[model samples]
Target: MEKLKMHTPDLAEENYKKLAALFPNAVTETIDDDGNVIRAIDKDVLMQEINTKVVDDGQERYQFTWPDKRKAVILANQPIAKTLRFEKEKSVGKDGTPGGIDSQNIYIEGDNLDALKLLQETYLGKVKMIYIDPPYNTGNDFIYEDDFSQSVADYTNNSGQTDEVGNRLVQNSDNNGRFHTDWLNMIYPRIRLAKDLLSNYGMIFISINEIEVTNLVKACDEIFGNDCHVATFVWKNKYGPGAFTRGVASLHEYVVCYAKHYPNSIEAELSEEEQKKYCKRDNKFEKRVAI
Candidate 1:
């Protein structure tokens, strides 16, 4: 067998050279992900060299990216043969009519990948709405496990689902250089599968933190198509000032919404029970309820 060697020159070196050519001070030796001192460019310093205070328009050249982004796309497209095994013990009713599933409300707790694959046969293009609250990729907080080299069958067959101590979740730490890459790999494929489960009039809402928001939106755009992007909602969930932050007071997180078609409209009607709680009446048709 042939051995792999350092075939391609370090991309960082070329990047530093370009930055150094423009701003010499910005180029300096820095410890990389591997802890080896290497020539690298200071992004903030390099940006300072640019003359524009304004960013370019999206149609021209803006993009969201990370290392091995194409791999994420490939992972999304790969078909998984895994199936969701039934959990008889955890069902609401032993007869398997849990939550009146005959009417389409049911719960199955298992590996999301396997569950999603199983869902394809029954729920493909049949779901009306989807809301996902994935693990927020904060270093040491939590992580999604994705072994890029392993096939779906390998995942189902392997016993490495849990760590040494039996923890199912993985940790994406700050020092683990593939932080963003690992996250992108995990989320992209799941979102892609979930998108397929949506009907023509369906929509998806994803709650995410700032760290992966940009990358997530780009991945969603690629999977759901750019025209499907509906809105990015900023939710001020805090009642008061939040925990200590670097510069700005923290009070908001985000929900990114996407639709199966372009220019979709959201319609909401208040129920009679909810409408009865209205305490005030206004002159502007005093009857419109707040969604």
Candidate 2:
């Protein structure tokens, strides 16, 4: 008797092999998130196989892009071998002491991208809300430098440039030519992973300053869909005006909100003072209002 094949088929890997057989020229090698060399398909070369027009580097198109944006997307989809380790000594129990594996609260200290990937198994499409205050990329911020273009051999040889844990702690200074590009690459993959964790009714609130607000919004729109954007609230965080500068001295930051799926309507409760003025029969509902 023949033995059973108990494993499920890897559709993605099967499709990749099929495509490579069809277009051998498009088959290429690239480095994954973990610095492992992997086979990749050159999208431009694959597209040209079925296109009539010239699909080369000079083609005009509408896109929100920076250097290595494709690499960022690739890194988001790549799987990592790293796993989360349970630390009993660091955990707090319901009584608020250490050595509490039964604690509801868990703190993960490591690269966030790796943590996000690990959480996908448990939290994918289950989280209702997520709030993150990422680095503002104010030229002084130390952004994660992900080099997916390098192989593991090259990375290990240059491990001295990274931190003890192999984190490339590169500062995104204004002097750096690829300052914005580096920041985008760092945040792009993280957000891509975050989107997978959201439920259908899930919402994400991201706090960002004016420096990269526009770019961040564009990136989120691409990831979460343009129709899912709920609001962008301006928060005046400072009391007095900032110091003199060449441009305007802005006193506010922005909180951008996006939902996993667009809602039919949104409602909010009226304040006590406003409720008194409107009376019970103001317009629609009794106490709450829609905005």
What tens digits encode model 1's per-residue C-alpha lDDT throughout 1-291?
866332322334444566677799777679989999987666667677775554444655666677877776655555554555555445555455653323334676666765676676678889989999987787865555666566655654563455443334567787888888888878887898898799988889999878788888998998888888988899986776546656766677899999987543466876887679865578777455432
Worst 10 residues of 1 by lDDT: 4-13
Off by over 4 Å in 1: 1-63, 94-104, 148-168, 242-247, 276-291
> Which candidate leads the pack in TM-score?
2
RMSD of 1: 14.1
Estimated TM-score per prediction? 0.63, 0.72
**Over 4 Å off in model 2, which ranges?**
1-59, 148-166, 242-247, 268-288
* lDDT scores of the candidates, listed in order: 0.71, 0.81
Give the Å shift of residue 150 in candidate 2: 5.7
Model 2, 166-225: lDDT tens digits are 665666788889978888999998998888899998889999999899989999999998
Reference-based lDDT, residue 202, model 1: 86
